[model samples]
Each structure stands twice: as structure tokens, then as C-alpha cells.
Target: MENLDIAKFGGTSVGNFDAMTSSYKVVVGNKNSRIVVISACSGVTNLLVELASGKCSDSKINEIIEKLRDIHEQIIIHLENQHELRNYIEGHLKEIKEQTLLANKGTNDQLTDSIVSHGELMSSYLFVALFKHYGTDAQWFDVRSVMRTDSKFSCAKPICEEIKVLAHDKLLPLINDKTIIITQGFIGSNTLGETTTLGRGGSDYTAALLGEALGVATISIWTDVAGVFTTDPRVVKTAKPIPELTYIEAAEMANFGAKVLHPSTMIPAVRQEIPIFVGSSKEPEKGGTWVRPVTKSEPNFRALALRKNQTLIVLSSPVMVGATGFLANVFSVFAKYNHSIDLVSTSEISIAVTIDAGTTTSGKAEISENMLNELRQFCHVKVETGLPLIAIIGNRMSENSGVITKAFDAINKFSVRMICYGASRHNLCFLLKDGDTTEALNELHKQLLED
Candidate 1:
């Protein structure tokens, strides 16, 4: 007998009542013993964040509340058996309103988790009701009882061992009953029993985590896009979808800039060597991208992704002539701030590192001024902004000679400042002016994939 599969849907896929109904049809059509994970409704998280931060006026909060009520109400009306489901949705909305008022008195961070969690909570509740209305045997399960993490409000780390044990003990019985379990994702409880979130767009990670624990055959992420593309279609005119990718290739693409999949979402799936499929909610027959272990075929091009608003910081220390521990001390400051270093190149006199610029509303680098001031302790530090990093990833690149040389030669006309190839040879990244990111991606795509 085939093992059960796990299907996870993102925000846009379940943005409203109609989309939710469409997603339910897709899941039912699969007909596998499965667990479904859902994210918050489209704009609910942002609205809740605004309300929690006191940025939203009373009118705005009320407006959001009414709008959310209408969305659920519409779903209730469309449901075949509307009486019980309508009552259930109405009751859940009342509970959410009361909880919102109670949470407003807490700290912003705690309130943020509380309010943002409502998105998943409300969506999952309605989903279970809709499933039952459609004559599917379904039940709602609160993920917090199974997924345990620390008290970190926004970015809680999953305690895998504890989660595995609890999930089998608690959720397996529900699965054995042949029930399709609907659960809220991106929200979990700490050892202290306080609600915590796994950061933005973390529902994907939740699905993968559950799949890993259950040792499921496959995890499907149903989203708005067809699949992972060579470049963001909005940015590149002729962007193409990558049919397949290795785990390392997918991780690099996600880390660099692919918005379809979260970087952390792959950890659990990879740990268990479970295959992941990224498909479309709108067009399920299109056959979206698949990610798994490396294959034997030599793929010409895996994918291209870009990270913009990068600040290149160059540190030149003439004071110490080859002093030991100087680099260590310099790096410790970044570690203290929990800042991530993306690209690095060092010489005897100078060290250059590229970091995300923390862009502003105008899309200009906001970190250039602040980072320049911090680098004053060193003999000389220069900050350059308006740069972007382009990542080209493929497992076959490890054995393929001249891949980097060919790629660099293709983009040689661009004002590239830095190039860093990973030691594993799975990724080749280059830095160029933000203006050239699109053109470079287009040229590389044509040369590698399209041509």
C-alpha cells in the first residue's frame, strides 16, 4: 500500500472563500490519506501586524474585521450544508475578536505573534468546516500541541525530536481513522505554552516538518505560481520554469531569492530525503517543478535567482601587519548582531564582505550610512550600495568544467564587482550593479536554458 501524502497550501492559494473552495477540490481529487496545512488569508497577517503595533486606527481595525467576516461568511453561504458550518464560522470570528482585544494589552512582539496567528487559526477553522460540508471526513488539529519550540516569538526553532514523538502519539490516530486533518501552520507553542510564530511564509516549513515526522512519501506545496522559475517572471520577460532540481540547487535558489519556496522549508524534507513538488492551485495539470536528490541526467541549467539591495563593505587594516585574530574580532561584531554574510573576499590588507542592505521604501540601501559609521574603528571601510547578487545553481556544475568561466564571459560586459563560487561548486554567484541584474539573468537564461 502507498504511504499517505501531505499537501500544503500558501496564502494566495487560500486568500479568499473562492480560492479556498478551489484548493479543497484539488486536495479531494488527490484522494490520498493526507494532512493539509494552511497559511493565513492573504492580507490578514499585515493587518494584524498593523493593529498589534498600534499603527492601525480603530476604523482600520474594524474595517479589517468586517472584511475578514465577509470572507468567511461568503464561504459559509457557498457551502452545501450551510447551517452548522455557518454557525461554526460565526462563533470562531467572535472568539478571534475577543482574543484580539485581550492581546492588544501585551508587548508588541507578543501581540504580533498573537494577532498574526489568527490568520492561520481562522483559515484552518473554516477549512475544516468546508471539508465536512463537502462530505469529506475531516477534522481540525491545533499544531501547537504537536510542534514544540522555544519562546522565540517571531522565529521559533522547532524541537524536532519532541515534535516527532508528539505528532506520532497525537496525530497518527486521527490519520488512522481516515480523516483528512486540517491544521494551522506557521504557529506553534513553546515549552511555556505561549503562542509563537516561525517567521513569515513559514507555513511551508510546517508542512515539510510534519511530512518528515510522518515519513510521508511526498510533500506538495500548492501556490499561486506554476513552479520554481529560471528567474522571477515579473523581472525577466522570458523567464522559464525549472522542471526539476537537486536539494542543494533548490536551497541555493531559495536562499538567493526564489520566492516560491522558503530556504528553511527544505531542511526537514531534506533530512528525511522526501521529495517535494511545487504545483499551482489555479492549474494543477501543468505539472510543476519537482525537487529531490541529485539525478544522473546532466541538466544544462538548473535555475537563476537574484538578491538585490546588497551593500559591499570593504575593511582595510594597515594598523596590524598580518596580525592574527583581527579578522576574528571583526567577524564577532557581525555575529553579535546576528547579521548574515553573503559574499566575502579578503586580502592581506583588506577584507570585503557583502550583506543585505535593509532597503527603504524608495528601494535604496538604508544600511550604507549606518554601516559606514560602524566601520570607523577599522583603518578604512568603504560601503557601496545598489548592488545585486546573481546565483546560478546546479548539481552537475560540480563536475562540469568551464561553467563559471562561460558564465562570467557571457556577462563580462556588465559592471561586475565581485564573484564568489562555493567550495562545493554547486553554486556560482556574482555581484553586479542592480541595474544589470535583469539583463544578466536574461542573457544567462538564453545561453544556458533557452538556447
Candidate 2:
């Protein structure tokens, strides 16, 4: 399958009957797209998350299950084989409700993984049924069969070599022009065959991983947006879709919260040098951005990304003023807690780092109070909330003084808490009060991207 291509549709792309129908048409229209990765329906995963949290009352859980049932029921009703698929969907939903009740008995990541996975599981089944209804031969393949990962429960790490072997043995022979393989993304299994997830937005990463394993020529990411934009259109109405971006630019944008792609989604694609096409499934003919090793255009100011709910933690120790391992020690604490830091800045005797406030991508606390207590052993820890990180993605940013001037000049009126630059030429990031996000984004986009 040298000419094979993996088309991964996001939740919005396959949210309903019409959306799934449109997606299958895109698949059949492109003969090379023999493999399809799908996410949960748009609102199904959120409801599933609420159900899995186990914090809700029994009635709330039942209500959430009904809401989930209604969402899928609306789509399943449109299929010609609606009766059979409806039975299958109801069976899964019943299981979800049961598992959720059992999960509330204790805090179990394993059970949570199983509870939320039904979204993709049932959606893939419906998608296969829908695909067949459209005269296209499609088989629903369990991604866990090939998508092997460590049993990390909520946020599993893929065992790359194992997945490659599994894909070759289980997936390669079945994939052909005669039939398309439909599979769920973000959900995988471990050595013991327990269900696991790759955190939120892992569907995009799944597509890239499969693309690399199959050595596909191209990976297409279909979403609600036409392409990667200068900024979120919701935040700035004038935000425009970017036509092309180098892999570095795309990776930076994703890492800094562009939301169009998962941060880790770019890794396998970059390693394999596979080109990725991101477009709107609703309007595939209008075209979208192409992310490659190099793009024809390399602007100094390409786009802006705003990451909300950031907590700024400043560790102050006079020893850090002239110490060597101070930064390493601080990072080791974060490593122990398994929390990732987005941006950091250091002064003469203090270092401040920004971590996502509230819960992480896996639906767990970003940083625990105990972690903070441990840091207090050697330094004074000051924590500030309600700060959002804004990233300016571009090329030669460090080398271009004028570009940096224009960027800061735009948002200089805002009280910038912490700034991180000179480390990555592709991005310049800073922390701002949550309240300043809209106005700051507007000012930055207007000056940097629009001007």
C-alpha cells in the first residue's frame, strides 16, 4: 500500500448523520484513502467525561447516558440498517452506564479508560454501517489490536516498535482498494489487553502514527476549520486561515494551543518526513494548509496561539542566582509529578514556570499541593492563577528585531507577567491575565498577521 493515505476526521467532521455521510464521500472520492481514523462524536466525549468523573449523582450519570444515547440515536436513525446498529449502540451505552456506576465505587484510571472509550467504539461501528450504506465496502477494525501502548490508563504512551509489528501482521493484509479499514483513534490496549487512551486530541496523533506505520504518502486531517489559522477565529473574527506552514511552524503552533492539531500529532509525521494536509471536511474543494519540511512562504510573523488557564509558579531561592543544578532540581520535581511545563522564565534568584491550571489533558490535576510542599523545602513558592500563555509562531523571530518590536508593541499595554523567547526562533510566548486574552489577541493579530 505504498500509495495509501490515512484520513483522520475530528469529532465535528463526523458528529452526525450528514457529517459522517460527507466524510465517507471524501474517503470514497479519494481512492488512496483506504484507512480512516475517527474521533468521538462532537459532544459525546464531553458527556462521557462527565460520566466517568464519578462525581455526579446517580441521576446525573443516568441523565448523561441518556444525552449520549440521544446524540448517537439521532445519527443512527438515518442509516438504512438503523435497527441493527441501534441495538448495537444501545448495548454499548448500557455497558457504559454500568461501568460508570462501578467506576464511582473508587478512583480507577483503568475503568475510566473503558467508560469513555465507548464514544469512539460506537461511533466507528456507526461509521462502518454508514459507509456500507453508501455503497462503499468498509470493515470496522479495533484499533487496540494494532495500536499497542503502555498501560498508562488515561494517557498511554505508544510502544512504537510493537505497534509497527502489530500493524503489519494485523492491518496490512486487510487494507486494499477493495475495502476501507475503519478504526477508532485515541483508544488503544496494553500487553494485558486493558483499554488505554492517549489523552485528549490523541486522534490526530493516531492518524500520524498509522500513516508512519503504513508509510503512507500523505496524512489528511479533516476538521471544522479549513486549516491552521493566524489565530482562533472565535477569539478574533479577522483570524484568517494560513495556507502553508513548515513543520517547525506547525509543531510550534500545535504545542502553543492552536487546537487545530494535537501537540504530539506532528512527531511521527516529522520523523518520517510525511506531508500532512489539514482541511475542512465540509468544504474539501476549497483547499487547506500543507505542512511540510519547507514551505514556499516563510514569514517572520505567521500566527498567534492563546493557551488559557495557565498557572504561573515562581520558585525563588537565592542559591539559584549562582547555582548550576537549581533549574534541574526544579524540573525534577515537575518530572516526579508527571506534569508538563509550557513556558518558563528565570531571573537573578528565581525561576517561574507556567503549567496548565486545573486538570491536565488526562482529566487529572495538573499539579498537586504535595508537589508544591516539596518545593517549599528549598525555596519560596509563589503561585499565581488566571494567567494565559500567548505564543507568536513564525520564522527567524530571534534574528529579526523589527518583528519582535512589532509583536510586543501590539500587546505592550497589557501587563505581561512572564516572557519566554530566544530559546525557539519559531515561537515567542508570554503570559497575560486571562481577562486580557481577547483584546491582546486582537491587538497582536491585527499588528503581526494582518498588517
Candidate 3:
């Protein structure tokens, strides 16, 4: 198969019949052999989360069920001759409903993954049947069969080598034989053959992994938006679409709160030098952001990423100005608690770090109690919440003259809590009061970007 590209449609992209129609056009218009990945219809995953979390008990479960039925029956009524598929979806929903009636059990992550997986599973099945109805030669695949992961039910990391072999053995032949091969994103199976889900915004990760396994050079992420922007459009109205970015730039933007793509989504792609294209399912003519290994032109500063709900943890210890294992000790607690932190500014006497307190997922707490207690053993710890971390992202930022003064000038009006610069090649980060995040972004966009 020549020119095989992976195209993944997001939840809203496959959310309804109209959305599916647009996506079908995109899938069918392509000249190359393509693999199609779809997420659950919009809102389905959240409902599943409620059910799986036991947030909706027996008394309240019926409400979520009615909503699910309304959403699916709307589509099912139109997917002619797929009674088998409809029954399959209905069965899964019924199981979810029944499971909710019982006390929610097992690893919370595992239960949530299993229940929420219905989103992708149902979406892919309905989509494949639609493609067939419209005379497209599409074959549906259960991604769990091929995409292998650990037993870590939520946030399951793909075992690349194992997944590569499994995908090659199972998916390659299907792609080779058909013009279109359809599968779900954000869901995989463990070695135990139990259902598992990747973290939030994981559909992108699934698409890229499959593309890498098949040796495709690029993967297209089809979503509701047209492209990645210079900054979040909601924050800065003048934020325009960036035509292209290197993997580092995109990864930095993702890490700094570019919601278009997941931060870890690029790891596998970067390893194989597989590029990514982010585009809209509805409006394909506008083009989109292209992320690859190299770029024709480089900008001094490309974009700004703002992450809110941050907690700044400051640790001051007088063990000595020079301490042997302080760095290791502080980081060890992070690992022990499975805490994912963002930025760090260190001094001889203290360490300042920022993490997303909003990292709480469907049914999990962000801060770990044991980790916090351990950290207080040796250091005076002060935690401040309600701060937003704004990252100014670029390439070769160290060499960009005046970029620092200019950024600082833009946010000078805001109460700046911390600034971490010259530490990372891709971004210069600033901590700001939550109230000042928007004001800072607006000023920076005006001062630093071209309208």
C-alpha cells in the first residue's frame, strides 16, 4: 500500500450523523490508502464517566440512560440494516446500566476505562456501517485487539515494540486489502485482555501510534477546529493559525496547554519522525497546522500556552546552601505519588515547582496525601493555589534577543509570581495570579504577535 496516511476524527467530528457525513467525505475524497480512527460521539464519554464513577447510582442511572438512548437512537434509526450493530451497542449500554446498579468495583481506572470505552466502540461501529451504506469499502476493527498496553487502566502507556508487532500483524493486512480500515481511538487492551483507556486527549495518541506501526509519514487529526493557533483564541481574539511547526514547538505548545493536541501525543510520532496535521472535519478548505521534524522557516516566538488551576509548591530548606540529595529527594516524592509536574525553578536554598491542581480526572484526586507528608519532613513547604502558568513557546529561544524583555514588559502589569527562563529550549514560563492570566495573554499577543 503506497501513501497510507492515518486520519483520526475527534468526538465532535464523529458526534452525529451530519458530522459523520462530513468526515465520510474527507475519508472518501482521499486518493491514498487511509486508516480511519474515530472517537465516541460528543458527550458520550462524559456520560460513561458518570456511570462508571458510580456518580449515577441506581436511582439516577436512568437519567443518563435516557440521554444515551436519545443520542444513539437518533443515529441508529438512520443506520439502516445495522440492527446487529444497534443490538451490539444497546447491549453495551445495558451492561453499563446494570453495572452502575451494582456497587462500582475494581481499580477505579479500570472500571472507568471499561465503561467509557463504549464511546469509541459504539462510534466506530456506527461509522463503519454508515460508510458501507454509502458505498465505501470500509472494514471496522476493534483497536483493543491490536493496540497493546499495560494493565494501567487509565493513562495506559502503549508498549511500543509490542504494539508495533501486534498492529503490524493484525492491522497491516487489513489496510493492504482495503481502501478504508476503521477503528476506535483512546481505547486499548492490556496483556490480560481487559479494556483500558488512554488519558484525556488520547485519541491523538492512538492515531499516531497506529500510523507509526504502519510506517506512515503523517497523521491527520480531524476535529471541530481548523488549526493550531499562535495562542488560545479564547484568550487572545487575534490569535491566528500557525501554518507549520516543528515537533518540539508543537510538543511544547501541547505541554503548555494547547488544548488542540495532547502533550504526550507526539512522543511516538517524534521517535519515528512521523509528522502530524491538525484540521477541521467540517471545513477542510481552510487548511490547518502542520507539525513535523523540520520547518521551512523558524520564528523567534511561535505561541503562548496558558494553564490555569495551578499550585505553586515552594520548598525552602536550610540543610545547607549545597545539599547532596535534595533534588533527588524532592523528585522521588513526585514519582512515589505519581504526580505529573510542569515547570521548576531552583536555587541553592529552595526549589519552586508548578503542577496542575486540576489534573484530577473523572474520578481521581490530584494531590497525593502521602507524597505531601513526606515532602514536609525536610523542608518548609508553602503551597499557593489559583495561579495560572503561562508559557511563551518558541524554537532556539536562548538566542532570541529582546524576547525576554518584551515578554516581561507585556505582563509587567500583572502580579508575576515566578519566571523560569533559559532553562528550557522551547519555552519561557511565567506564573501569574489566576485573575491576571487573560490580561497577560492579551498584552503579550498585542506586543509580540502580528495581526
| Alpha-carbon deviation at 220 in model 2, angstroms | 0.4
State each model's C-alpha RMSD to the native: 3.9, 1.5, 2.1
Worst 10-residue lDDT window for candidate 2 reads 357-366
* Model 3 worst lDDT run, 10 consecutive residues: 357-366
Ranking by TM-score: 2, 3, 1
Please identify which of the two predictions, 1 or 3, would achieve the higher TM-score against the true structure: 3
Global lDDT for candidate 2? 0.87
lDDT accuracy of residue 155 in candidate 2? 82
In the range 340-396, model 2's lDDT, one tens digit per residue, is 887788899998888864233345444689999999999999988877889999899
- lDDT per residue (tens digit) for residues 1-451 in model 1: 1667888999888887778887998898886737999988777676666656544555766787787777767666766767776666567556656556665554345556776787788888878877887788888999999989887667678999989999999987788435789998888989888988887778888998889888899999999888888788888878887788788888888878787887787899999999999989878888899998875554646778888878888889885576888788777767665556778887788888888643111122334344455666665877787688888876556576877677777777888788887665667788886675777888877776676
Which should have the higher lDDT, number 1 or number 3?
Answer: 3
**Superposition TM-score, candidate 2 onto the true structure:** 0.97
How many angstroms is residue 85 displaced in model 2 relative to the true structure, after the best TM-score fit?
Answer: 1.2
The number of the candidate with the highest TM-score is 2
Q: Is candidate 1 or candidate 2 better by TM-score?
A: 2
**2 against 3, candidate with superior TM-score:** 2
lDDT score of residue 20 within candidate 3: 91
List candidate 1 segments past 4 Å from native: 80-107, 309-314, 355-387, 396-401, 434-437
